[model samples]
Target: MSKYIQAIGIWFLIIPLAIINGGLRENILIKLGDIALLLSGIILSICIFVVAYLLIPKIKNCKQTDYFIFGIIWFILTNLFDLFMYISEGGGIKDLLGSYNFLTGNLWILVVITTFISPIVVSKIKKRKGEIKNV
Candidate 1:
């Protein structure tokens, strides 16, 4: 239970990183035109991985499967949160779904995929290094 709490708590940290990334994308990366979205997605993906690498190992008694489950939870929650935001902003299904169109330079799908995999990937690395106990 505590492990679940800790894993969910880590997501709070990710939310701020994502907001900051959005700010950077809007303020700085936007100057780069169409590439800004892709670059920001890459940056956010790296940030998510870094956060997971630094913190997931601290989750007591978690195996790689637990980490993977955490990733799944985060992925679902992340999408839900985005959906809520879009809806709140007067966006309908099209607006929400449109974000996934990578051909239009929106890398939201990549970001979600990264969010869905970061914890497990980090756990694998930590397990390889013997930095975590339960594998």
Candidate 2:
């Protein structure tokens, strides 16, 4: 579905940003093996979210609100995890977290935040076509 496409698109955008940061420090995660792990995470996360949506079967009409919360949590946690991962790989957590230009970090941040948010956004399109649950 279009949602899956959108999800993959978001990953393509974010993964590059992560790779840039990861590679800037010569972090090993930017290499082929780690790249595979990263891709797998993104693809799997997307599939899980889609399946959750399909199986839940009864979302509240407050769809945007639900997704906003999910996106915020996901964004914060994803960044934090990345922060720590880079730290463990020999980069200073504070440096990586604090040294970036706001503009640059914001791109990756937005990519991450919106990856989770896209589901809610895409669902609105389907909801308009009456793909909604009343339960």
Query: Residues 16-110, candidate 1, lDDT per residue (tens digit)?
Result: 99999999999999999999999999999999989988988888887667887999989988888888889999986788789999999989999
Could you tell me which residue pairs clash in candidate 2? none
The weakest ten consecutive residues by lDDT in model 1 span 126-135
Q: What is the C-alpha lDDT profile of model 2 across 1-135, one tens digit per residue?
A: 343333333434444544555454345433555344444444444544554355322444434555555455556556675777778878776755553434432233344545556556556655676876322
State the TM-score for model 2. 0.44
Please identify model 2 stretches exceeding 4 Å from their true place.
1-62, 98-107
Q: Count the clashes in each prediction.
A: 0, 0
Which candidate achieves the best lDDT against the true structure? Answer: 1
